[model samples]
Target chain A: MSRAYNFCAGPATLPEPVLQQAREEMLDWRGTGMSVMEMSHRGDEFVEIAETAEKDLRKLAGISDDYAVLFMQGGASSQFATIPLNLLGDKTSADYVNTGIWSKKAIAEAGRYAQVNVVASSEAEGFTSIPDQESWDASADAAYLHYTPNETIGGLEFDFVPETGSVPLVADMSSTLLSRPLDVSRFGLIYAGAQKNIGPSGLVVVIIHRDLLGKARKITPTMMNYQVFADNDSMFNTPATYSWYLAGLVFKWLKGQGGVEVMGEINRRKASKLYGFIDQNDFYANPISPRFRSWMNVPFTLADDALNNAFLEGANERGLLNLKGHRSVGGMRASIYNAMPEAGVDALIDYMTVFAKERG
Target chain B: MSRAYNFCAGPATLPEPVLQQAREEMLDWRGTGMSVMEMSHRGDEFVEIAETAEKDLRKLAGISDDYAVLFMQGGASSQFATIPLNLLGDKTSADYVNTGIWSKKAIAEAGRYAQVNVVASSEAEGFTSIPDQESWDASADAAYLHYTPNETIGGLEFDFVPETGSVPLVADMSSTLLSRPLDVSRFGLIYAGAQKNIGPSGLVVVIIHRDLLGKARKITPTMMNYQVFADNDSMFNTPATYSWYLAGLVFKWLKGQGGVEVMGEINRRKASKLYGFIDQNDFYANPISPRFRSWMNVPFTLADDALNNAFLEGANERGLLNLKGHRSVGGMRASIYNAMPEAGVDALIDYMTVFAKERG
Candidate 1:
C-alpha cells in the first residue's frame, strides 16, 4: 500500500512494521483466538503484555530501581492535574519553568492544586527561546520544580536538565522522549504522552521516583493516585489494552533499530538536515533559537504568509499530510517523530525547497 | 483459527464478524492508507467516524433530542465519581440503591463528593435479588436517585425502572445496555462502559438529559464535566479513536440485525435457554431469583465445589474459556452479551449438560 509522510502533531504517525504486526494479529493475537481488545486486562495474556511493555519502556528510558513506571490515560494534559495531586502534599506551592504551550498548560492546571510560582518564563520573548537556568527563582520549600523538555506547539526544547538540589525535578517529555539518551537519575519524575515518539495516543508513560508515591489529597480519585497505580502495577482499573499492546510492538521495533541511542543519532541527523535547509533559504524562517530548536516538531513559516495555503495544498497533493500548524501558532509544523524515517524528512525538505524556489 | 467460547464477565467475547472486519481494516481503514489508530482524532476523516458512531448509537438506543450522548474515557468506574461531581451541585445528599458490587463502589466514590443515603440494599439478601422499590427511603430533596440496572457480579437486574416522581433517576447500565430496549425518557441519566456489549474497554457511553449539562462542583475536572464534553462534541480531548470506530461498526451491525429491539428478544431467548437447562439439572444451579436474573451475565455453580476444576478443565478442552466467575463471588459466569451468538450459548448448554451428567 502507498503511504504518506504524515506530520500530525499527535495521534501521530506510527512505525509501519508495528501497524503491519497489529493487522496480522488483530483477529487472533498470538494464537489466543481473541483480539487484544477483547482480552481481559486481568487475564494472564494481557497481564504479560502490560508487564512486558512496562519493562521495555523502563529499558528504553534507562529507568532505575528508584523509579516506578506508570501507564496511564487522559494523555499529558491529565498529568497536569495528577502531578500536583500526587506530589504536592502539605506544601502549598510549587515552582514551574514555562518554556512554551505545554509547560504553561501544566502550570495552569497545577495552579488549581497548588500555588504556582513561575520561576522562569520564555513567554516574555514570544516563546521562541528557553530562559537561562540562572534566571530561575525556585522556591526553597517548593514541593517540586516542573518544566517541559520539548514544547510541541512552539517547537522549543531545553538542552540541559535543570538541577533542583534535593528537591524533585519533573519534566513533561511528551514530544522528545526516546529521541535521545538522558540520565534518568537526574530527574525525580518524567511523564510523556505516547502519541508522538512512543506508540499511540491513549497511553501516557510516567516514570516517578518511589518517594513521590502515596501523598495524594483526600479528594483524589483512586484512579489518579500514584500509589494506587504503582501498588497495583498500573492495573488499578482496566487499562487501554490495545494501546498498551501497540506500545509494546513499538518498543520491540525500537529495540530492533539498535535501541534509543542509535535512533537518537538518526534523529539528530534528520533534524539538522531539515533545519539546515530552512536556515539556508531566505524564503523560509524558523523563529526558535538555534540551541533550543526541537528535534521532533519543527515549526516553520514561509517568508510570505500568503503562500501558506499553497505550500500545504501542494504538499497534500504530493502525499505529505497534516502539515498545518497548531491554531495557537499557525504556519506549518513538520513533526519528525522517531517512526518518521530520515527519507521522510529528506522528502519533506525537498518539497519545502521546491515550494520556496517556486514562490520566492 | 480455532477459538474458545470465552465467558469472561467483561473485556468479554466480541462478535466474530466485528473482529473479522477489524482485522481486514487494520492496515488500511476504508482505503485511507492508514489504520484508524494512526489517524488524528480532529481530522475530517476521524470526525466523520466519530459523528457516525454517535449517530448510530443514538439510533440503536433510540435516544432523543432531550438527551446528549457522550463518548468518554475511564470507563463506568470513572463515572461513579463524575456523576456526583456533576450532579451534586448545591445538594448535600444523594440517594443510592445498593444492589450489588458495582452500586456499592459507586456509593463509596460518591461519598467523596457528597452525603450518600442508602435508600435500599440487597447485601442482607446475598445480593440475589433487587430490593422492591417500595422499600426505598429516597430523599425528597436529594439531587438524584442512583441505581444499577444490572449487577454483573451478583447477576441481578432491575426488571422495572424505578419511578422518581419529581426527582431524577440515574442508572449505571454497563452490563445491561444494548441487551434490551428501554424508554430513554425514563431516566435522567444513563452511562455504560463499552467492554461488555459495545466494542472495547477504553470507551464509555454517557447519555444525559440536556438540562443536566452545566451544574458541576467547582473541583470537577474539565474532562469529567458533562457540559464540557457536550460543548466539544466529546472531542474536548483526544478520544479513543479506534475504539470509537469499532463501536460504530458494532452499532452498524446492530442496526443490520434489526437494532436493539430485536437484540433484546435474542438476548432473552439465549438467557432462558441456558437458565432453563441449569434449572432442570440437579447438579447445576443458578442462585439468582428467576424474576431478577440478568440476561447479560448468568452466574451459577455445581452442586459440589470439588468438581469446579474438573468442570473448567473439561470445558476448556472443549474450547470453552474464561468461564471462571469473579473472585468476589466464586463459581462460574457466562456473560452472553449481544456479541455472543445463540449457537455459542447452545454449545455452552450442551457442554454443561454433558459435564453435569458425567460429574453426577
Candidate 2:
C-alpha cells in the first residue's frame, strides 16, 4: 500500500525521507552499536547530534547568538504557563491578543499567573479575522505582549508580526514555526511544539533572547524556569532524547531540501493550490477571512452540510487521511506543513474536484 | 554488527523485538498507509493504540480502577514539581525521606510549594544506605509522604514499603517500574520515566489512587494538574503520541515475556550474577549496603580508581557498551532493565573478570 497524505493538525505529516532515515537507524545510529533511543542524552554521540541540530536550526532560521535555541519537553501548551511565569517579573499584568483557539488558551493560562489585559480579540466574529493593530489597546505597563501567530484549530493566522515597540513580543509559533523563514530579531522569544513542522511530539523548540533569562516567579517550577534551562543547556533533566535525535534528522532533511527559503516556496505552493480550489469553487468555502486564513492549516466547509460525512468518507477511501477539522469548529482542515509535498496537495485538490462533481 | 549491551542509566536499553517491530511499522502502521508518528492522537487508530496501551499497563501492574494511569511528558524530574503542586492541597507541608539524588530533588521541588519535613535522610552517610524507617519523624499533618523507592544514581532500593499511616505515599519509581511486580495498592501514587524499563524518553507513566484527584492548588497550571490529566484521560493536550504508541508496544512485549512476575525472576537472576561476582571478588566493590542496593541498577568500583577509563575501553571493544557510571558519582553502572537480556549480563561479567585479571 502506498503512503497516505496525512492532514493531522499536529503529529502531522513528516517527510518520507525523514521517516526512512529513522527506520534505517532504529537499531543502530551511525554504527554506534545502539539505537539512538537507547543512547544516553549526555553521551558524546548524542551530544554531537544535539549540537548539530541546534547549529542547523540556527542556520535554517538565521538565528543569532543572542537567541538560545533550547530543546525542551512538554508541548507549547506548557509554554503557555511557562511564558507568563518567566516574564511576569515585577509587572502585575500582561497584554494578550485573542486571535483564535490557541491564543484564547494561552490567555486563559496566563490569567492564573498574571492579570490578563486582552488588547485585541477576534472572538466577536467567530475568530474569522485578525483585529487590526491600530485598534488594539495594548498596555505599556504589561510585562510582555503575547500572541499566537497561527491558530491551528480555527485556521486563522496573522500575515504580519505584531510590533510591540519596547515590550517583549512573545509568540507561540507551534503551527507555523519553520513553514517559512522567520526573523528572530523581531521577537523576544519564540516557541513551537515539534510535532508539526519539526519531528515528533514531546520535544518543544524554544528560541529566546538571552537577556530574557532569570526573571521567573518564585513559585515557578525549576523545569518551567527558562533561566535554569539556559544555564543547564536544556539538560536540567533528561530530555526527550529520541524526539531530539529525530528532530536533528529532520533539520538535516530540511537543509538537504535547500533550506527554509525553499521550504517556504514549497509550502506556499501547496497551500495555494488547496486554498485556491476552495475559493474558486462554489460548493467549497473556507470560513476564515482571506487575510487571516492560515497558510499552514486550510480549513474549509462544503456548501451543503449534509455532504460532510460523504466527503470525508470518499477522501479517506482516496487515501487523504485525518482531514477532519477540530471539533470545536466543524469542517475540514488540511495542515500542510513543511513536510507536505506538492503532490499531496494536488492529490487532495483532484479528489475535492471529483467529489464535488459527483455530488453536485 | 551485533547489538551491544547499553548499560548507561537511561534512555538506557530497550527490547530488540520492540525496535524491530517499530522499524517494520515505521512507514505504514498496520496498512494504515501512515506511520504511527503521523497519526492524529484523536484518530481512531491512534486512539485504539492509546487505549490498548493503558489497558495493558493496568493489567501488568495489577492496577485497579481506583488508580488512573497517566502518560505524561517531562520525565520523572518534572513530577518533582507537579506532585507537590497537585497533592499538597490544604496541608502546608509534606514528608520526605531523602535517600539520594532523585529524592533530594523531589524534596527540594516540594519545598517551593509546601513546607517540607525531612523525615529521614541518608545524605549524612554519603547516600550509600537507606535510613531505617523506625528512625523516621514523619508529620501527621503533612500532605503526603514522598520517597524514592529506587534511587537510580545511588543504587539504593527500599527493602520494605514505608507505612505512611493515613498519609498518602508517593514515589518516583523512574528506574524500577516494570523490572518486578509491584503492589499498586501499597502506594498512593507512583510515576516512572519511560526511557528505562519502558519504551523511550519523553513519556512518564503515573499511577495515582483516584481519591487523590481534584485538589490541585489554585495557582497550578492546567497541564500540571493531575485532575486535568485524569479527567481528560491523559489527553488534556497533544500528548507525546509516538512515545505513547511505543510504550503500548513495550507493554505488549512485556506481556509476551510473561508479564511482570516472569520479568521479575529474570531480573533477580541477572542482578544476582552481576552482584554475586562483584561481592565475591576482592578486586572490585559495590559501595552501597547489600540489602538496600538496587536489583535493577548495580554500581561497582574497580580496586584501583585509575583503571576506570581502561575498564570502559575494554568493555566497549568487546561490544559491552555504556558501562561507564554516571559522572556525578563515577565508577561503573550496569543497568539491567527489562530489555537487557540475561546474556548481556553474562557478557558484562565475563568482560569485567577478564579486564580485572589483565589489570591485576
Which candidate has the top score in DockQ?
Answer: 2
Q: What lDDT is obtained when candidate 2 is compared to the true structure? A: 0.90
lDDT of 2 at B40: 89
Q: Which residue pairs in candidate 1 have backbone atoms (N, alpha carbon, C) closer than 3 angstroms, thus clashing?
A: none
Give TM-scores for every candidate, taking all chains together and pairing residue i with residue i: 0.98, 0.99
lDDT of 2 by residue, B288-318 (tens): 8888889889999999999988898888888
Worst 10 residues of 1 chain B by lDDT: B26-35
Error of 1 at A190 (Å): 1.6
- Give the alpha carbon lDDT tens digit for every residue of B104-148 in model 1: 999999999889999999999899988888888989999999999
Docking class of 1: medium
- DockQ (C-alpha based) per candidate is 0.62, 0.83
**Model 2 complex DockQ against the native:** 0.83
Using lDDT as the measure, the top candidate is: 2
lDDT of 1: 0.88
TM-score of chain B of each: 0.98, 0.99
What class would a CAPRI assessor give candidate 2's docking? high
